[model samples]
Target chain A: MEPFEGKTISWGEHNGVIELSLHRGPCNEIGSETLEELESFAEVLRTSAGNMHTLIIHSVMPAGFCAGADLRELYRRAYQQPRTSGNSIAEVRNFLVRIHAVFNAIDDAPLVTVAAVHGVAFGGGFELALTADLIVADRTARFAFPELRLGLIPGFGGIPRLKRDLGNGIARDMLFTGRSINATKAQTADLVSQVVAEGEALRVAHALASQVGKFDLNAVRAAKKFIKPVPHAELLREIDIFCELFESPAVAAGLRRFVESNSPLPYLP
Target chain B: MRTLAQTTDEILTLAAQQFKVARETLSPNDDFFKTLGIDSLQALSLLTRLENHFHVELPDYELQDVSDFGTLAGRIQARL
Candidate 1:
């Protein structure tokens, strides 16, 4: 009935189809605290069983899906950013690194990770959908990248993931504008695998998961593992550029100012 | 160059397919917003699909002009 294990994300199993719903309801918004839960959840999903085949991520809200990282967290960080917070500066630093890790795990999972999205999925929410091997969107589902609007780049691999998922130009448009595109456009943009008739997102996703559950999990895992050896120089380029920005004083000040201001422009950053 | 009717049929058909709806549901002369009740998801999917299929990228600002079938058809025609 419930979906949590020791204050972290929980998984529900039925006929070998694991539904890892985000129970951090009210918004299902990701943040410093939830990053660890996500990372741990991904591990649980990925290493579940040799026979297990699918992982479905849905939210507990009626307007379900995620709202991205908490802006309140951003504000808190801006206010109390440590001078020399090495490795991970309390909340912000820890969250940034861990969220990326969680996404990587989701992307690399042996079984297909399906994002069953409805209502609003913006910024990190969009990126979270990007982490899925496939996405099933409801007709009313809204997808967006509002980070720029808040004067921040999506720290959890929005640009890189979008580029790899949709291509560079499309990624730029999504990132620079911070506009919310509807679910169908997201599918057309090749951002998702499919879209179902309204209210059928979760149902369709579950059906697909059942089908996936019948597959040979080991072979699937091995195939994914096989793709691991390819050169990641381009990925490294993106990460390096990102890290350079992280070290930028102008960026920090700009981010601080933007977080402080009533409105922040996401484009300049 | 393709005739307007031919172009309209070609693009609209592909766009309709992107909507994952039956071909009978969409028409060159049909009213898009009215007939399709083009809500945001449907509208966006149709727009993005049309853009990608035609290799013509219509930005969000441009999308605002296309509220109905006739309007969207006209916008596509103008781009051509």
Candidate 2:
């Protein structure tokens, strides 16, 4: 698909399955170039006929899936270096917004899209996995949203989706503490739909793809239409207020008292 | 049709499996978010586990109100 043009990644059909991969050496860093490739690929696949009955987003890297943005880009921006053609934080956020839209499109595509994850999926990479209809992960898959530790939230839809998936309280811990959930825990948490042996993520995903790819494309798309989008405007405000409340003596003392006792959330703690 | 008892059994079984504990330890009558030591993280974790396990999504508010084994079971049964 031309949506991901001039990028090392690829999208093509083989045996009726459309393969989507980040061919940029598996490291698949979400930089300026990668986001452009994703934007192009998503649009083309969204409309093409039978070109994407099964979309597989596999890593080309040996270590893991995507690792989010390049810190070197951040370092460059702080120094005002002309590296990525006006690569400001706003530009990066804009690109990620497009990336989020692209992933959303894939989730709603007529085909079944699966993520073959093995290794670390951090930040946006972790969020990208959330967008997939199915995540076939290996035992080595480590999922984390470490942005909160860096004073950032999931730039993509991770915050909203994870909250939707896991529930608000648990996701807040993930967002606040930035702790990771290992593969076993991921399977328990339903982060990954299936967990196979290490390095066999792609094979299992392809197998699942084969089973699902033959279904009615229209039906698959229809099911997605019925699914609800994340409703986080209120929750996000609550999160902000929660943060603000953390500073209040009322909330702080309330938290301490609640922690001492055993009161539920509607009360405190 | 699955009875409320059956759905409660399934949901509690799934939640127990998720938290890696004995289902007997979590009382159906106990408050989900506080009693049985169900914190918010574990609460969300259990809800996600239930969603993927059952292949049906509960409304966000319904999911939040699943504060006890009985309530969680009721919520799952209602969706069914």
| Candidate DockQ scores, in order | 0.05, 0.04
Fold similarity of candidate 1's chain A to the true chain A, as a TM-score:
0.79
Tens-digit per-residue lDDT, A1-269, candidate 1 = 22456342567777766787766654576765677777767666656644567778887675458767666566566456565644323445545666776777777776667999886777777778877778998765677776554435677777766766677666777777756666667778887777777678889999998777676878766765674322234434544554545554665675566557642122111
Error of 1 at A146 (Å): 2.3
Model-by-model lDDT, in order? 0.65, 0.64
RMSD of every candidate to native, in Å, equals 8.0, 12.6
Docking verdict class for candidate 2: incorrect
What is the per-residue lDDT of model 1 for residues B1-80, given as tens digits with 9 covering 90 to 100?
55567767776677566556677777766756566555443455565456545555455656554555556666766776
Cα-based lDDT at residue A35, candidate 1: 76
Q: What's the true lDDT of residue B68 in model 1?
A: 50
- Weakest ten-residue segment in model 1 chain A by summed lDDT: A260-269
Which candidate gets the maximum TM-score versus the true structure? Answer: 1
